[model samples]
Target: MNPASPLDNVRIVLSHTSHPGNIGATARAMKTMGLSRLYLVNPKSFPDSEADARASNARDILESACVCTSLEEAMGDTFLAAALTARSRDLSHPTRNARQAAGELIRYAHHHPVALLFGRESAGLTSAEISHCQLTVQIPANSAYSSLNLAAAVQIMAYELRMVLEEGVVADEPDPQLPEPASLQEIEGLHHHLEQVMVQSGFLDPTQPKRLMRRMRRLFARTRLEKEEVNILRGLLTAVNPHKPT
Candidate 1:
């Protein structure tokens, strides 16, 4: 283990992880790959027996894992944060497979502390959460069933890094995105209005909306709407409303 190698310096961040076992397993996976840094950002549950038990031989990692109150705090000093999202997101960040993500990690690790952030098992990374990351890793999978466990996502990325680092093929170029990144508050407001419009248009039924929202999320994600585009859509939406604000 190069005490100072990229893999050693890279931190595996679990954001709002719900399961203790996943936390333990994530530590074990990180350990198995010769990684030691683990960060927990507002875990739903930690310091539990199951998690400690699952960590088993890797308890040191659990003990050493930094507990952070927020993702921004956990990402402190990290110039490169790559989040694992099951599908595309509205924010346009460079999307890569596990290999490419690992390569980027290693490339940036020398100058800065890099983080690989994974979200909750059910929701994965939220749009607001994804905004913090500089890039995203999309594991190629069947479109029909693409869900993967949070820990599993971490393991795959870790394994890829271990392999590529051993072969010494780590390098990266710049990641491109919209010139002006939209703010989180802006997106939240837009989504709220969007939901109302969908409901008013009878496109999204409140009763069984999970799937519909999921699909809509994917649609907006694919669009990677820019700030100007978001404004245009919101403006058009407002213009059509019969009762405009005075």
Candidate 2:
């Protein structure tokens, strides 16, 4: 069965792409997988002849690639956005390998439009850019020489997502039926609440609190806590500091 939406509908966003050839190659990759939506966020150059030459017949992808002023604009309405990065992020947003990320892309696409984010070629996505995503995607590489080029990275990931579309799942992923995650606003509030509790209880010394919060934030992000877990934590904080005030 064909995908419910056209390839033109799948937006492949590139932030600060420096190579024209890589942009062309990325278009080819999406075309081969029947995914066509390409969004360019402040790309180095567009309508480059080199890019068109590399795209060949897939020039349509280049021709139609949406140019956005910012990454925020490109991914604003997208329900699920995954930023591909090679290194670990400092804030430690949820991370998934290529295969697992492909599954999530499929699942999220079931309800809302999804966006796959790619960063510049020299260095992959920056920490700030990754923070913009709900989760991060990393491809497992050999212990040595782990760097992947922009086009190659997108090609590998796009191939994985296409495989999921072509071949149905062999074993279904577990379904916990958890409610949606708390909004970013609520999560930020939870962090503030937790911070207040830590300070009021003398659990964290103000002078050394940065390291403590950084590690704790990393620990908390991995849980991918559902709305309920966050609520539980909020309630726990209230119990701990009845008079601390939010």
For model 1, the stretches where C-alpha displacement exceeds 4 angstroms are 171-246
- Segments in model 2 whose C-alpha atoms lie over 4 Å from true places: 1-9, 170-246
As a whole number from 0 to 100, the lDDT of residue 153 in candidate 2 is: 86
Instruction: Give the Cα lDDT of each candidate.
Output: 0.76, 0.76
lDDT of 2 by residue, 91-197 (tens): 67788999998887776565456788999888878766665567788999976988887888888988888787667773334245746654444555677798888
TM-score of each: 0.69, 0.72
Worst 10 residues of 1 by lDDT: 172-181
Worst 10 residues of 2 by lDDT: 1-10
In angstroms, give how far residue 167 of model 2 lies from its true place: 2.0
Cα deviation at 198, candidate 2, in Å, is: 15
Candidate 1, pairs of clashing residues: none
